[model samples]
Target: MSTNYPKPAVRRLKVYAFDPQASVTLATAMANDYVIELPWEQRWEAPLEKGPVNDYVEVIDIDPAAGLFYAPVDLDDAWLRDGGLEPSEGRPQFHQQMVFAVVMRTIRAFERALGRVVLWARDERLSSAELPPGAIERNFTRRLRIYPHALREANAYYSPDKRALLFGYFKPPESAADVQASWVFTCLSQDVIAHETTHAILHGMRQRSIDPSHVDARAFHEGFADIVALLQHFSMAPVVRQLLAASHGSLREPGLLTGLGEQFGRAIGRSKSLRYALEALGDRARTHQGSAESIAAAIAKLRETTEPHARGGFLVAAVFDAFVTIYERRSEDLLRLARPGLVPGNGLSPDLVERLTQEAAKAADQVLRMCVRALDYLPPIGMTFGEYLRAIITADTDLVRDDPLHYRVAFVEAFKRWGITVPGCISMAPDSLLWDSPRPEEYPALIARANGTPEGETPPQARMDPDDALAWWFADMLKRLQFDVAFDQADDGLGERSAESEEQASSCKVTYTRRDYRSGPAGGRNLRDLAMRVVTHNQRAIHQWLEQCTTDRHDWERLLGVKLTPACARVADVNAPAALRSISGGTDPDAVPNVEVHSARISRRTGPDGSEMHMLIAQIVQRRRAYFDPEEQKAADSGDKGAIGALRWKSPDFWFRGGATLHIDLRDGRLLRVLRKRIDDDARLARERAFRSGDMIAATAAVTGNPREPFAFIHRGS
Candidate 1:
């Protein structure tokens, strides 16, 4: 290796490696120039003795010894992956070491093909004799590509065999830093750069996409990178001295205040490093996400709702939490490995960073690979709260097989309580080199998808038959209430359609007896349990409040605060007021639906038709609908509207549907009353009004025509 006018070229091929320089630094604290200092005990054995690079990847020419490297520039079309990699006390040193591990793994993959050392360096400023023609690079302080929309670069291409990762950022050079961020190395602070580049290299080794649609995806992206980047700071001497002094000249259990950024913070007379944080918080670490409590709340939710950061932003928060644990744990692990009772601020040799970085690199390498593999099966679009739970389950399902010791079991099962299930596609079998599962891809059950889409699969929809739709909604609510009482959990997995069949599952059953109604005027009933669940309930609540609204001759006021004419809440009593009678049809029965006659659970028989029906009954609800069509809306907004069709809820009109004939099922038929009620007494006489879906009601069996004869219970299906 000669340091001449021109640097020797280093072939860029991905490979596997064991950096001896790192090992020496870890085993001893000797001032070996080659052996860099490591803060954590990072020592990992390489998995493959060797591997080869295939297509979708090629060796780029670059000189490592002379500090110059050449690679292709095709990042503009690269897709960003939300690979979920994080550091933990049980694993790598922290964020910085994790980054190094990923980078080293990537470089080794390249080395296997190109057979040379790899160096991450920005483009040289001066024209060198060995420099290629038109090799201009914009630094992170200068540029970060342009138009960073996920749509433009939504698909990343990687070839493990090729040992190449093809991607780019939307970092267009707008101002100085925007331009500077363009260079892969310059886009991040030194630590952040090392961390981000590690992501690139890791992508080439095992292709994956970090979920971008969810908070966890974004957080993991930043957190894991931060951990990796920070650990690398220890590898440099100048930075190490600054870190040690700030740490009060110690290392064991020392907080990050010892790092260079902390010293800078101290120089400015602040408890924390604001400048460094401002610079690092954007794309790498989001630890300063407004308030620590908010971040903790998110983390707690992640833990409670999903396993090992499986759902919500838990996956994202897990990475940072893992970093904290890993940093403290590695510091402790180091004490056990060498010093017995080392205290914080007791500075170790600077070379220790290289050791920690290498060890961290090795630990990071394996975990990241696991993350990459998990991404292939995740949903391509919108991530709901449920999806997050599944993400963690699917991710660690494999990790459980090889490294269960390091990966906690209780840590994972925590998600199951939140309704997360293992993805069937991801089985115990070693997946293809590409790591794909036979995904039973399912989309959410939306009203629009009732007809099914290109996938040729959708939930069965019974269309919007006003009578049927109203009935169905009522039935659904009853079923939900029944299910909630039975299961006692919100997401009991009852509403979720099966991935394969796309059919709704029932944890509880509710059969409708009857329905009847008449158009009086829009009125509302209190739906207390409703707002807790269902989207339509929210709309209904809004409309209910508007019914009580009242107003003056010039300007009317609604009962619940909205203003309108007397027609808003028209009492169906014809004798009350002129407007009331005009709208309510001749003094509609001043009726409070009271069960005058109780029905007995008598013998019920099946008809020729498979559909089961029940005794006569009535149901009610305040139904309102808001429909939108472009043409109609435009005309209405422009004051061109004369008479617009409005969907309004008509109460006082009872809804009745489905009736059944009674038969004695009891063989020795005397009087078998599975359920009973009194009917003879005028005070006891009852007229049963079928309960609407939201109505909390009770029922009993009875004989229809004869008031004296109570319906008998019969033996049915065993």
Candidate 2:
């Protein structure tokens, strides 16, 4: 149990310069010390059930061969005492450290892109965006568990059920032709670890994406994981420079950045990597941006492939292609900057190489954020490649209105090359696919209510200062909500003090402080926090009202299993305004215009194939659970007296039991349709009956010692 104690903070760690593949061909192969601010430790044998002992990561080398948590590199004299010259030279301790470092690095990247904390699905309390009682929240699965040697095969996976990353080590190919070595450890490979961690992080954000109901669902998982790993390669300045120096600015040429999991591929006796860069499509295969017909042809060819990897690879290729295009364009300017006037045709200067590398790195960083942030704009379920393209466009459009460099245009061109077209677009123009903001006239009540005036009274002059303006606006909104609240600036009587006097004083005097109190459930919370709560409450109320109207109009009957209730029937708020704010460049929440929650109440709808149905279409349909399963009570009642660390079987963690699609008319505030998730009773009964009959036959055969087929007696009579 002492081993479960928190590990000391890691100031710096020397890890592999890159993956083993990059080390083989790049000059930047020297192990570099990476700074990790959080604490981490290795728990060789013990496993943690929930809370992490450390802040960073908890490495659980589940393999029996993984002896005591001995990480020599953690000590100051590791390089002098132990022969720790090269961390990448296949040491068990180094492998454990590398896996932990890479996983944390990947987590940080996602956090940076979202501009907020990255919450894992296992963090039950902060499951949704709702803030908890403590103004500040810590990670539930604080230190992500890593199984460095979980299996003996060339496979690695992120287990959502366990909330741990399982990495495998495989024996090299037996054939003499395969010269890589005896063992291929996936944890050692940066790409492999990064890829697996990305899967975990993405699932944390969107759990529904794991359901492979649609083709894009699984492919998105694989492709997005690869993209994160691929972008990480560009993140390291040294790695980019080495690759640029080797290829002489021709990124299309075979290099470390062009291929993924090189060491693993070679060990398996493969000529190429698991995946190659899209630039390898060849100069002849490249589709010009202007050639729409040609791009369409390429897309048609890609669509012919149904396999997840193949389709996913195509998407990776498409995005990578855009990165390459941007890199090339940005590098041209750098090339000229390296050598003023006409650039030399001969070898380039060292300064130019560094400049060019920086440009490429910058461009990749932007593209990476664009890809990750786009996830917020995507649908909850049933996404297509084209829909992803639309998400990218809309997400970028919301953040940056003026794209003078036409970075978005370049992405549109790249997507077009692969024949990835936006669904329901009026034209091929990039703006056509971008998500539209609500018209100003849509939500008049929000402004009317927050106007800081009674029904028959005239409003006072607005505050000119931005902070004062927001404070005033927030107060007004609270008043409109019928909440009894008061706000006043508590100006400290103390005025200007000499610099020496201020320094002599223990603490500085408070110049300004706003005191606010509300007579409601949100009383003790911060005033701004309460304002947000009010806004959120109002938004959900509107949605629930619309839903109630629709259900009343339809006169819906009760289902077989569900117990209806006022709270259970209430529709969930999809947090459209927050999502919009993510892309919206507005600094002041008060200054931002009221969000228009648009919806359509259609009597009938028809598909392009000519099929028609009477229904309503919502602006945005969110996936919600029909009910919660009482798993904790079931476990307690089962008389399982095991502690948190006990290895007991747990029932499935289905966050949502049953699913339903609520169609709302956002414009008119109406819930038009309810498409509930259906279960086939006939299929369920047949399968259960077959299982029971087989069990009975198996029991009889076991007792009689007769190796007979299940239900053979019944067949004999026939």
Candidate 3:
């Protein structure tokens, strides 16, 4: 404890100093951001080495990046002696750990969202290939390089090209002397670090999503990042409890939870925060109006602004409102648990206070889970706030069918207040807006057939399990599409299938392929020839299957309602135009080109109940691939390419990028869900327009414009 260097261990760090915008801060003129010690129960500790190294990330200085920051000089000692880390002795390492801690925390958040480990694109080629499965990390990440002080400026960005987070620092304005002197580091702010980490994680899951295609595309990135960072502040249980107690149990009372980035805001001469959720505009008329009315008016005002951050504000506000509602509803139970005659307005006993804080923490945790899980239900392209609401409802309904607490209702109400609605929903009801389940009868039939249960015998118990339904349904559907349905004999839960039993199961398989196409003229293929190949083969089979699924003329027809279909496909036609636009701005009906079946494997996973949930994970991709040699790309970047080749290079990747991952529940043989990554033509066009207009909002090299030209003043010195 008395050595020249302080040892590293679990220690508390300031979660956030006084939120500058908090009413208390304004009244008290608090000097530093509040710090909280570590060892948080909810915090995830990644596999780390001395530079506080983790498998997925490497913390390094901005220079050559050869060295790493081992640990801060006893953050505990610094905090105990001073209010926070001293700017001169501890600020550098302080900023390093802050970035590392928040980045790890954000990774954990995304893993929760994806329901699996985040596999970065680099992981596929570099580290994973050599490591054993689940061995701490098999190809965790070569190094999602983090530069705590990459530039001398106000902005920080995640560069997909470099696969690194570059935090910039700059001299604080003269007015921000309260926080620091000489410089303000973006890396030092928890919000900025969390926000940038989200971008990296999102890119790993859905890389194409980084494209500035639609208004919501880039805005979704920014807003979703803010949501993660903001919600994470709640996980600092001590801070949240303190603020809640201070605000008299009212989260809406303009406290620490309502604002983000006080230090950054003050450094930039802003009075409150860099951005705020609970703050209302002048037109909001906060004191007199009801909660919903005020939220609605604020949303209306927000809509008048077209900037990505402003639009993202609408999403943040709605979600924040939902959180508040849930917290209030949950507090009701806590109040009931309080001593007799004790109410919220009156000070409660310590026991009751502890109970209230615990309940509030639980509410925040559940809300964060809901937000992350909803991502799996969202479409791969052209997202809108309305679609997000629907995704939330559908995702929640699938997981928790009965919502006694009306959490979904709270979300719907919040969105409705903002006048956001799913385009095709019949009403505002959560039930109506939710993604409809497959017809109940289809599962039984599919499961019965897959299990090869004799006619009238009660389908196997495993088949009766609703969660496993999609697996069998997918098997049956594939058979109908003329696929070879091979029951996984290895899966004992599906029953042993020997060579003899395999032949018997084959009887259930239907092999159908329509092949009627004329030869190409002079060895050249046009759109017409491509259409012939598609309509005559896979498209015809798909069309016939859709017809059967839609109608009830046959015994199966009445039972199966196909809820999924191919979103896009590719055709190879040298004589055809560069690209053929679909009539409805999607995929052409008769053309199923460049379709490749990647893999289809049946596996069993144990459910929370310990029941085996058979799952068929099938992946198929439409390759609208782009092939440009590295040297050619460099030449293009150098502006040395010919007009024709350059024009060709300018075209977008024609083939649909990431394909769909079908999650088929084999328990009851139903299509549990489909996770797809396909292009939306409208969104693609919008992206092109944005590129032309140079209005890209995301922090990525893909934007291809001057980082300063749009607003040079911010980056003037750097």
Candidate 4:
């Protein structure tokens, strides 16, 4: 019944020194006392020749004398040891920092998991830009934030295929080299730095899990990062002290540590709370910006619309809930840690910080592992919440081999609360394509098969229950199905969320087609999804053709789905002022005005390798292709209108076997840069990779109904 916890592995940590003597550090007398949290065998294997270019983060040793510390080298003993070597009496050491606070360790573990090397701050190229018109000119570059400057002016990039982390925030690591230049990102918010860099890691290691195509995945990506940043405050002794003092143990109270970014925006002049937005939403949820209704309602109408990250969003939800649990528990415990002696005059004590921090970090690591473990339940491409649970149960069974009771009990317990019931998917193998099995300590299944279809391949006969279809497409059910109190089977609990329903899906059906010989492999979702998109496209086209603007908010809601109700007829103020606040009561007033219109209310997920570009066009009718200024990018970026060079997927010759090697051609405004490439491999590997790519985004795929034949789908960008 209890966990037979494995003996802790003794880790031999080799801390690479960043000082003038970039070698001599660490106490020789000390045993390998550090815990090897992840087994070395669990580390991802990468060919030595293709060494981690972006796997490990590059760190700049903060020269304490100058007072600017962008980064401390990741493996430095000074950063890892308690009390470090700093002579300061009360100042905390690096080991004392929160688990996420140990930016170096975060980089190190991520690199091992992803098999890439990170280019730390010391490896960046910097250049100053002369003022463009309307640019807020400033000489105090040190005060500027990191990402805006780093992304625009810097050279670093996060590459998924390469699994590398690159940073444009570098300065010289050599002592002899003088620190002459001033970089734009000298003053960075810890939360922003953590959140943005995490996107890179998630992209490389768990690409499908965070696909923006799915609402859960998109919200998860945003919300989980927020939780990570929020929990990170527990790691910093001073930050925790200030926060607790501000809240007086009321962690849930607004305008303190929990003030969702709006009021904090007033404090620092930023638009949103980089933290606590979810907690502020209260028991009753609203839009992300406190605008209209909850995003769930908006997402309901978008049932037919599949976001790239939709399937993976469930994992994000699981992570957020765990953080919610942990924080609530920790907040209750903080009462015990409070004292009259700590705050000097009040009751806050810094001494309690050490234990509280260690506990928080340990809890975070466990949460991280649990979330990582949950990825096994996730399909590499698009999946539904029901299917996601199936994946989780199957994955956990393999990882713990049923020896750990918590794996089963914990997951089943956690999911049921969120309306996520466990499915009958437990497996010993990690997947059919790979021989590898799941690991409790290590992550498997980060990558999705090119094809969205599962290798199980065997399809289940449709019992023809609405619950069956609703299992996968609940969002659509919420949109289309109508239930009245008078006639609806309320006792059946046969609503959208329930797996049992009185109504059956008529207009839509999902079919997973791979070959002529193989049919109905669990009645795969390809057909169901395709039907939805077809309807959506037609609906959109018809609405646009109508040429009549809506008088109210819900005017077009019915047009989005089958159900039309009083809610659908409600009018919205077309000329109403911009509601920058989310329904959840967060605000982002200072957001760059040029950013594209993402509905602040709802989060949308996408397919695997979730695309940053949302544009999807049947074919741009516009002729005499025009080269316009940067302002037109939103059209292309949103995946709606014609962006240049979107035909790569359509071009079978260029995109077929092994597809074009992609590079960024910023030389012009194009998002995709490419060197045409083709690869030849053994038959099996080829089929698998082909399926993976084609199903995810348009590329070469096995012609449905033909195993031997492969066809090219239009690549969005070439």
Candidate 5:
């Protein structure tokens, strides 16, 4: 492609607002069709061969049960590119288009929130010593594969092992006589597509979160995905306006906007959608308008629910409740302006409806951003709903110093109503819930070094603190990462460009003329391109730096909450060729533990007052072999070479991971806070053992030996 050729900023595609079934209704027949706009790919070559592939996802329409390979939708085709293949139940290409568009939209939302390009989970096998150098980076998955028609059953899920999404289609049950469509495709549903995509994205961010470690572990995955999917419906203003018109500008009412998987739910013989966030309000509450008693009963029911979807529903409800509160607060003035004495039965004027729709959409967008931003602040493993609330508070507080809109307050009150409470917090106040800041006095070494005299000559009050040095060293490493440059360029290109403006730019018919889209200072370099370049080119350097930080640093074991010395006895000599010899049992007692530098990226967020806060978010992970047997676990914990060597050479029952997520302020070289899970915490270890031995194991047990495909089982019946 020539540089002079004009490339469109966005590609508009028509899709169903809710699902194909919504179009069948006489009132929603025309309103159900929605046109979504995606970023245009100027580099895509050969429209027919490319299919609906993009930088983040690839749509592969393969149906094994039907023994059919549906031709991939050529999104680059001129006619299709202009307006997209019309929403149709009969066409398989339309299904491909729908999945691709929704997946990209979800991905873009995440990238915008996180301020970086999304990277899929790396292949675990490539980390072995047997693999050649640079194999991990060379084999990094850049695009998530999307199979619109893979299974014959009703379930659809994201497979971490295959790095693909498998969407299924099924015939409407005989009991579902009201369903108009004979076959229900999960790919056609925007909620289903977005939900599965979130799983993939979340797994990439925290690969170990899929483990069924506790009640909240797996449930968090299901609930968070549901929340994302449900909130996404409000992003489309036109759709929200139409939905508001039906419900009289009330989100409390039962409607397509609040329901998920409507067509599939109906096809599966359900009177309603698969799930509703408003259900947390209780039937009586929704029917009889709102009441404290009905809300209290609903919250109690949420506490009793244990199944993943049901439990996760409470999380969705809590978040949706916050959104509702925020929306109501924002639109209260508008409601009053419409009618001073606005009664329950009074009709909303067109102007009031438009204003309320905008308020609802804005509130939803803010809530969604807060939720997504909280992901970076969460501990890399073992996430709970209570901790998630803290993450949300801390993340939002960091970006927006002042909460004039009371968004954080709304989140806190809602989570509390749903029985979610953070441990160790003095109160439900937002300030109390914020992650504790690192005190310099507690870290004597860093303070001494900062105030030390010379390298050789120490001051009277000088004292060496290895842990503080490590923190500073990590900060220096972040400085070397050069995230600021990449993010600065990304801001110039992507941050300022709004979806509305992009759609308008590409709306009019135009010819491919001499024009340059790369006229900006970024020069066509995006955040992904720049960030990936830094990571891929410096993979070995990063590994070496991490190894150096962990080597012989006993203080790091306490500072990072991970074991650094006394490498696992089960690790083969080939894997640790440079292992330090131990006096007892000839084991490698001094060998350095494997430290995984999971991710280091920049977060550039603009506050409500036009203030910018740039941060370097990094995660460091270390895993230790854990045993189910109490005696064997004691032996492993003893740290005695002879005792550790006496244990069986067989693989342990599971790996216990400990790591910290570091939030470094770019304005100042300060380690703001560290969110960590301790690997050697006896209490946590006991909890893990009990969880594995108890019925919780059944919650996420895989049909096959492969545990990586948990979503297959999680979404089995959904």
Candidate 6:
């Protein structure tokens, strides 16, 4: 291979600004086309294959319902590479291009926020017993498969079981307006593509969150995806500017930016978009411009909504309300400067519109970043809207010590108005909701164990505090990761290029690159791939370390909320794997509860004031089998260990999980915080049981057994 081989840093593709319907309207037609510049990396020496397949995602344009295989568009083609195929509903290739572009764009947003490459959820079929001895390598997914036309219905979803995104198409109803096309393709909608992609990204971060543990569990997933898709609209400056001009700088007005799935929503017999953020306020307040009374009314309704999408709408509205608040604050000066006494319905000057657009984009970007960063701070499983509020507050406060613009305050107030409140918080203050930091005195047993001594025995490392010991362990594990994979500097494939680069190769633009790879290895590899390889290779060692330090320690159990020792026997008829099941019919002397180290990654975030905070984030989860019957669960929750142990003889109804997310600062090797959900908490267990046996379950009883693919049914006709 030639050392000087050149590849463009980005491939710009034209996609619909919103959906196909936006292109037909005179108001939005001029701005309906958008050019998405995808970060390009040349993995192979030759040009990309027809599928436009890359490391992150693969676009397989097969219309199985139509019984036809559409050839994938070659994005590497000279003409298409220059400006991409024009946006067209009739063209299958364009559908492929649009989905790829929007999906990649969404992926890039998450990567930027996370400060690390995004990995998809692992393959669900892999079992521990099937693996050979000492082989910790489970099948981690490489590419998220995309089928542009997988079904002949009005739906699209990210399937965790299959590790693929299936988009559908359907004919519009006769009552549907603006019916120029014969069929509506979900793949052609930017909102749908981004929303589904967000689901995949979120699933990668929190695997067990897909379990409907509470009303907010699945609802959080839906609302969060919509939030990402809606906020992404502001990133398109031209679209925002055009909409702002039309609405006279009032984002409160109904428009394409706030409504999702414009074409599909109308086709499904809706008057406007499929679902608008403003509608969360109820019919009377959709046009109320987010008044205090209107938002409170919306909050009251949130308690009554149980459907995933409908309940998720409240979360979306809360986040959108925060964005709008931030935007208004950010653009207040611009509006004042444009005109001292600007009227509500008056048109703004073009320059003022441009300035307002920048402000809106900036606000949206900041809010989106806050939402994404909060994912790291969240508990590994059983997420709630109230918990998400705390995550957003804590995550942002950690990065930006002084919130001069009051970004954290905006989020708190918005969530508070929507009736979202942390369960134990005394007040809605930001500091009151932050996750408690770890204390040295609280982990005496863990510290003693870490020093290689028994509970009271003083060892050589007795001077080391709990924080220092934890930091040391985390640092040691990260050292084993060997993040510095070697790469040839001359090879553009291995170098880090900015996502904003859009110039063609002929322009001879000197693409600025960062040296993320070091000089010690022979092969070029992706950072995420290298990290996963190292972690998986040493999975057993890591698991053993965590289990040994935490097992039988009351302090550790309190801190992490997982039961590690005194493993109860496997329940009868439980569908768990052998490795996950306890060995005996009662308390097992030889068995330790299964401990899974899901992911450990480095987070390097920079504050606005040029301060850098680098830390390691890792999650640990453990599962326990339990019955769904309230009486059985109550007996198990009793203080008697005998009763808890005896329940193992009966058939288990479900697997209950407890987990913790660890945030450790690298500067001084100090433990920052541990966010957890307790495994043995009777209240939580009761809530989960109720949710499982509640109206939500009865509504979806037809799809009860197929929990692995929750998105498949939830996204139908959505």
TM-score (C-alpha) between model 6 and the true structure? 0.85
Tens-place lDDT per residue, model 2, 234-337, is: 87777677668767776666556766777776766675566665644456345334375777677787767655556777778788878887888888767656
Clashes within 3 Å, all models in order: 102, 4, 32, 87, 1, 0
Ranking by lDDT: 6, 5, 3, 2, 4, 1
lDDT of 4 by residue, 570-638 (tens): 222211111111111001122101101111011111222433222111110100111123233233323
- Which candidate leads in lDDT? 6
| TM-score of candidate 5 relative to the true fold | 0.84
Per-model TM-score, in order, reads 0.29, 0.60, 0.64, 0.35, 0.84, 0.85
Candidate 1: regions farther than 4 A off: 1-317, 323-334, 337-346, 349-358, 384-393, 399-404, 409-718
Query: In terms of TM-score, which candidate is strongest?
Result: 6
- CA lDDT, candidate 5, residue 697: 34
Error of 1 at 191 (Å): 5.4
Sort by TM-score, best first: 6, 5, 3, 2, 4, 1
For model 2 the local lDDT of residue 276 reads: 69
lDDT for 496 in candidate 1 is 42
Q: lDDT tens digits, residues 1-718, model 5?
A: 5669666678888888888888888876766888888776545221223558755777888789989998877777778867789888899998888888888889989988887778887666553354442122334676789999999998999998899999998998899987888888888899999999999999888867788777788899999999999999998888888778767777876678888988888887797898988874544344662346655675577667778888898899889988888998999888777676566776777777899889998899889999999999888778789899999999999888888889999998888777676778899899999988765455444444444443335655554454455456566455445442211111334356566545533442211211213534434322233344355433323445544433334444555554554433232222321111111221125433455666666678887788888887766666666778877666655544455564452356676666778787877656788788876577887887777776443533644445767788778776
Task: Kindly indicate the candidate among 3 and 4 with the higher lDDT.
Answer: 3
lDDT per residue as tens, model 1, 290-395? 3445545544555454121123223323332333334434445654564554455565544554445444444333334333333322332222333433443444
lDDT of 6 by residue, 107-140 (tens): 9999889887788887656644455322323566
lDDT of each: 0.27, 0.52, 0.54, 0.30, 0.72, 0.75
RMSD of each: 28.4, 16.0, 13.8, 24.4, 8.6, 7.9
